[model samples]
Target: MHLERLVFILEVVGQKGRATVADICAQSDLPKPTAYRLVQDLVSSGLLESPARGSFAIGKRLRRITLSDYSDPALLEVIAPVLANAASAYGAAFFLSRLRGHWVEILHVATPETGVSYLHPGIGKRPLHACSCAKAIAAVSPELLSRDELKGQLRQYTEHTITNREDLAAELEAIRAKGYAECVEELERGISSVATTLTKTGAGSTVSIGATASVRVFTPATRNKIGKALSEMSQELSCALGWNDADAERICA
Candidate 1:
């Protein structure tokens, strides 16, 4: 009843990017007046915000709660230093990505001192097929990319981007076999990334640890080194997150 309506309203606002009371009512069977009242209540409670005069969006409080539940601060403390060390060592940018609802987004970043012309992609939803971070998780958790919304609809950011569904399917399979994913100028020209999925826990949050650099810098050996590093860090973090080897095999394998 009320609970369902609130969840539905949140979903509508989330999916629409910004949803108005009228927009929400139109999507659900709730009456216009009831929707308006509920929307106001949500805004008052800090779960939603009126970004525009009439449109509503996710609020600061909700985002905070989501982040806390999905990414523990203690774990992130360990992750941050790992990214900094990796970035410094490789002379590249190291990033941590996490699931936001159903979307995997860049959560944090550490960049090397010398790079101004590299690591252009910023914090936002990552392409499931083209991004090594997203692919790493999607390889283990296939349900995330198998949704109807993404089937055969992967956007091509560069010539190397895999747009074909069949090709992308094979790519995911390879990622599983390798235990890491590498993007060779797929998301952008000259920029490439290598990522591996974090070990899973019962909390249901999916994350990836990755490193990005200029194509010229990653060369063959450097790429392998970063890939190995990401894999090992991902494993350590996975253990700290509390799932055991048997559980990982059951859930991932």
Candidate 2:
């Protein structure tokens, strides 16, 4: 009975976007006190967000749960061909990633036959400010990083890394205007990358795709090519994910 009531409360909140104690009680047909207690339990456990004194919505823990499940085989099966094509066209490694909490989580990587000369960050969480995929995800959603958050995490991994919060802001603006982000040996010496946000999940989280190679391989012309490729790939992926074609074009444009 307790589990059923809890699930009923979560369902009501999820369907309504947000709910107050009265809203949950009315929707779930529970007594006001019981509804309030269940909602408070969810908020305390991090499964729901208390946005105000009484209002609640889905929380980061639930978002994290959805993101972690992005490794579902069907989604990967659909994305594999696209990554292969992008990797082949640009002669660089391609990857898919998402912004989760304060870190960028690497979801997938598709490398060229020759492999990349630069060291990969591997498949795991990476610092948001230091990688092109993260920057691209951030470019589309700047509110994810408060000024204080940026300042606190501006650890320099290489001489080219953006250590200044102001400079990073300017760079992100440029990336937004141009539809892609770049990391020039920022995370590792001799490595550079171009990236674009691929799509937003149904839960409203940003996911990105990118290509990277050694600085030597990513020449001025190569960067431009990769930038365009990343943008096009983002659009295609967004469409496959059921994003409106016109909206996707405007975002990637």
Candidate 3:
């Protein structure tokens, strides 16, 4: 198919970082003339750049589009496989969420069909004080709460919700020190979760990944295990996003 060939050419160029007509043809198994034409078209359209007479690399337009997607927090291409693995390995409902203003929006969720209860956090605005995903974001950037004046405005969803600013600040400090957040019956009764911040931004807003389960099912051992898993996965995701361990520590600190 034409679309398939176009995608193939792009993939080859992307993987190689820079490719020539010969390289593109070899990688895509296309005729030299066809590869040349496609590469020329891409270069003309600003999706690929010709640095020299024959070599091509990703263009400014493509990088700009990728940056736009990252800013929009719709980078599911990178997040999906990690979430799937976490859900399968942990036997819990894993979710990816982004912070927008004062709310943490559930962008994606992955859970097993038969083994786990449907732990969809539902796609919408969520509070920052009571859930692990939001808490993870808060732990990384406490200034969001301060800037939005949400510290004193937190609502008590359940008896365990952190209602006061002082207590919530202490909780965030603990989460920052531990590199993750855990919630037990805070947002809803009998539900518990552990979460870690996945992506750090200069804007002081963070994205997080987390897993949720019933309190009855999450023992201390399970909680510790899931917490470790989330933290490790978060570090991996952060690295993929170009944040090294030192960058992550400084940003989170």
Candidate 4:
């Protein structure tokens, strides 16, 4: 009975973006009485929206649930403190981003108390090649973009940004080998970042720590330290996402 109702609901929405009880009953192959009762129940439970008259569509509650589940809060909680600590220690801003469709969206950011930085990405989308967080993830996950697509158009966000496809490809290869990426005022002058990819059970994500500093700040020694911390935080996040230690190590390492 529940399965039948679920199928009918999906079918109703599939046929029409919104539906009335009578319309759903006819399209879903259910009796009018059953369709009406189920639709009322779904609407009451906040799964369906009834804005005017008898029209119904998927509701905001369901939409929020879908987004929240996909961008799991439990996983974010595990990494938040790590980012905060990194930001505090380095006196910089740290960000965690995830690839959302064709864009990278910043999910979290931590700003340092000491440094006065101008750029704040906030919760917004950034171009794949323009930000260190996006590039770090893309470097390890070339499957994220098609070869032809990547080669076709690479925008230069700044003079130092990698606009050439061939050069960017080579840089990505190095990032993959070394398990980290760095942007030395490449996206904007006076801003630098070091980033690493985060993966869980074969699912890939990225986190970057950025500061208002010169290229000199990203010395080999500093990068090594940051890389170690980033690797640890990635592992913790992967575990929160249901990845076993072996899987987490393989993905983050």
| Candidate 2 Cα deviation (angstroms), residue 31 | 32
Q: What is the C-alpha RMSD of each candidate to the true structure, in Å?
A: 6.7, 10.6, 13.0, 10.1
Indicate whether candidate 2 or candidate 4 has the larger lDDT: 2
Instruction: Give lDDT tens digits, candidate 1, residues 16-127.
Output: 5677888787666789999999999999999999888998988899988875323235456767887887777767788988654445778688887765545645777787
Assess candidate 1 and give its lDDT: 0.76
Segments in model 2 whose C-alpha atoms lie over 4 Å from true places = 1-74, 114-121, 147-151, 199-205, 249-253
Off by over 4 Å in 4: 1-68, 113-121, 147-152, 206-216, 244-253
| Cand. 3 TM to true fold | 0.67
Q: Kindly list the per-residue Cα lDDT of model 3 for residues 214-236, writing each as its tens digit.
A: 88877768888888888778767
Ranking by lDDT: 1, 3, 2, 4
Best by lDDT: 1
lDDT per residue (tens digit) for residues 64-157 in model 2:
8755333225346667789877676555788877654466767688876655444354787667788988988777777777846455788989
Instruction: Report, for all candidates in order, the number of backbone clashes.
Output: 0, 0, 0, 0
- Maximum-TM-score candidate: 1
Each model's TM-score, in the order given?
0.68, 0.67, 0.67, 0.63
- List, residue by residue over 61-134, the lDDT tens digit for candidate 4: 77676543333354456667777776778766678776544566676787776665434556766667767677
lDDT by candidate, in order shown: 0.76, 0.73, 0.75, 0.65
TM-score of 4: 0.63
